[model samples]
Target: MTTHYLLNKLRQENPLVHSITNQVVSNDVANSLLAIGASPMMAMAPEEMEEVTKFAKAVVLNIGTLTTEILEAMLIVGKAANKKGVPVILDPVGVGATQFRQEAVSMLLKEVTIQLITGNAGEMAYLAGIDWSSKGVDAGEGKASGREIAERVARRYQTVAAVSGKEDFVSDGRMTIGILNGDPMLTRVTGTGCMLSGICGAYLAVGGKPVLESTVEACTAYGVAAEIAVENKEVNGPGSFRASLIDALYNLSEQTIRDKENIKRYHVNKSEEGTNE
Candidate 1:
């Protein structure tokens, strides 16, 4: 797949992405969408979710700062998007950390037919019923394999699963890709994952590519931008890196994506062994 083609298509369409995200990262999420050339709207009221989702190209639901009221709105908007056949992305941030979080995420999975779910390895592992470690919103030390977890979760939910870490993984159970092009500094800043989820929503909003392809494109573009941001001498620290990252995103071109994307596709035989042969 051509990374530049999807990026170009997204810029041309500028589809509206509706995000019902956490308060801590709402501003960053909205800005990230705009920087990526997507129109972003943050609307979560139960009264307006269906109306907003009826016209929005994609919808992103995050459970970072979960609340009962917000949960209700998410259900409303998720179902609304499903009814319209609008692609829905779920970021189950900090799942398995609390009982309510676990229950909420499980409920959403059962209630909505999510097109994709993006999360750290820990979150994905939990969704797959694997034993992996997690702390706060970060994926902690764990024994479970990110790849296996992603594929398992994708199979279980029948949705595209994306597990992001030093190396990002995307799978739909049958096929998976390992995307290697991100800066470690991304973890230094809060809400970068949330922002990435927003980017996924933007790329998916264009609605021309499969869920896995759109996801890979979004993560690749973000990783490329982060690489550029950290390499910039003017970027002194995380704060500067954040601004520079956004600038890099704004300046990201189709040529750059075509030239710099680092992607690896993984497929398994009947024995379930791959990426090694």
Candidate 2:
């Protein structure tokens, strides 16, 4: 029941998403949106991005694999998205890995107002201007709590921030949520994080009170799909995990989110711990 409530809203709306993403997962990102009932538009041409973003519900910028041209497109699109009051999601993939990537993300931030920022602990810490020990694209093996990282970034960016780890933590600098229904196998796949950002774009299009709740709903749906995928994998590896994950998203029902949903959230000012807190 929970799945249909959100999915139906998204499908019925057929929100258009503008993405300036990495080449590595651009196709996968586009496919994920279609599976979840959203329309995807890949607009990377620097000249057309501004025009394309004007009509989109939201814009997503990712730096998984960077290029100067793509960076230019991102800034242009971001500015247009901001001008139209459309939501923007920034995903800094492997942000701490190099000066080039960090500089690129910094440039975009200076030019546009991002609505939601989602990344692993390491990427988020780096974007928040903290020196987090990281290895490549994956989040640092260190035990930096997702909640701590998300809160710091959200407050710093003045936007909703999400840090995904064993358990995902989402906050808008004031309210926080911890989602714990995903499986470790989710980490074995590529583009899952990227897809989550795209999912967020879809929810943002639906327009909820405060917008942050729309983001939380998207993350909950992604986590629930991961859990269901793991159950259906039956001891399979990442390949099977990927297929099952898509199936779970396509088959998600409202009853599952209402009954089996494991998402927990609370206002930050309340001084709570965990989702219930």
Candidate 3:
């Protein structure tokens, strides 16, 4: 696929992405979207949620700071996006942490028609209704491979699934892709996963592409930026690396993203054992 072509289209379109995300990562998400040449609008008011998503290119619903109020708003906005034919990206943060968290994720799945669900392996497994070792939002361990969990969840939800980790895996049931381009430093930073969800929102906004390809493009672009950010000699720690990550996103060229991304595409069947596609 011509991934960088989509990157260029995103830059040119600069689509408006409506995100109902956590307050903790609001600035990070907003600034990262700005750097990537996409507009970010963070609106969580129940009264305005549906209105804002009416014309938005994409809607992002995150459960990082899940509350009953936000949950209701997410449902309203998700329906609005569906009505408008706008794509919705759902981030099931901490789905394996507590009963409340699990219930909240369950409610979302039952209500909204999510186009993409992005999280770690534990979160993906939880969404797939399988057992996975987890505490808080971070993953502990899982019997299934990230690809297997992602594929299962995608089929179960009938939505694209992206399991982010050292090796990010994205699947839309029929096809799965492994992206090996990010930096380990991404783990040390808080809300980076949230930021990645934001990136996915940005790309999904500029539609006219398959959900799997759009998601893979977003992950690859974000991963390339992270890789370049850590390579900088001055970025010696998480804080600096985080800041450099934004700058790197702004300066990244479409040519570089196409040439440097390490992507492995796979075709998955009912058994979930994938073959190189």
> Across residues 74-113, which tens digit of lDDT does each residue of candidate 1 receive?
9999998998999999999999799999999999999988
Assess the local accuracy of residue 167 in candidate 2 as a C-alpha lDDT between 0 and 100: 82
lDDT of each: 0.89, 0.82, 0.88
Backbone clashes under 3 angstroms, per model: 0, 4, 0
Query: Can you tell me which runs of candidate 1 are displaced by over 4 Å?
Result: 271-277
Clashing pairs in 3: none
Global lDDT for candidate 1?
0.89
Model 1 / residue 94 / CA error / Å: 0.1
Can you write out model 3's per-residue Cα lDDT over 1-277, one digit (the tens) per residue? 4546777788899999998887888999999999998999998889998678766899998999989899889889988888888988999888888888888878888887899999988888888877888878887797889888888888888889999988999998888999998999999998999999999999998887898988998999999999999999999899999999999999999888988889998888656533222
Q: What's the lDDT for residue 148 in model 3?
A: 82
Task: Give the per-residue lDDT of model 2 (tens digit) for 25-102.
Answer: 888788888878889998788989867976799898989988999898888888888888999999999988999998
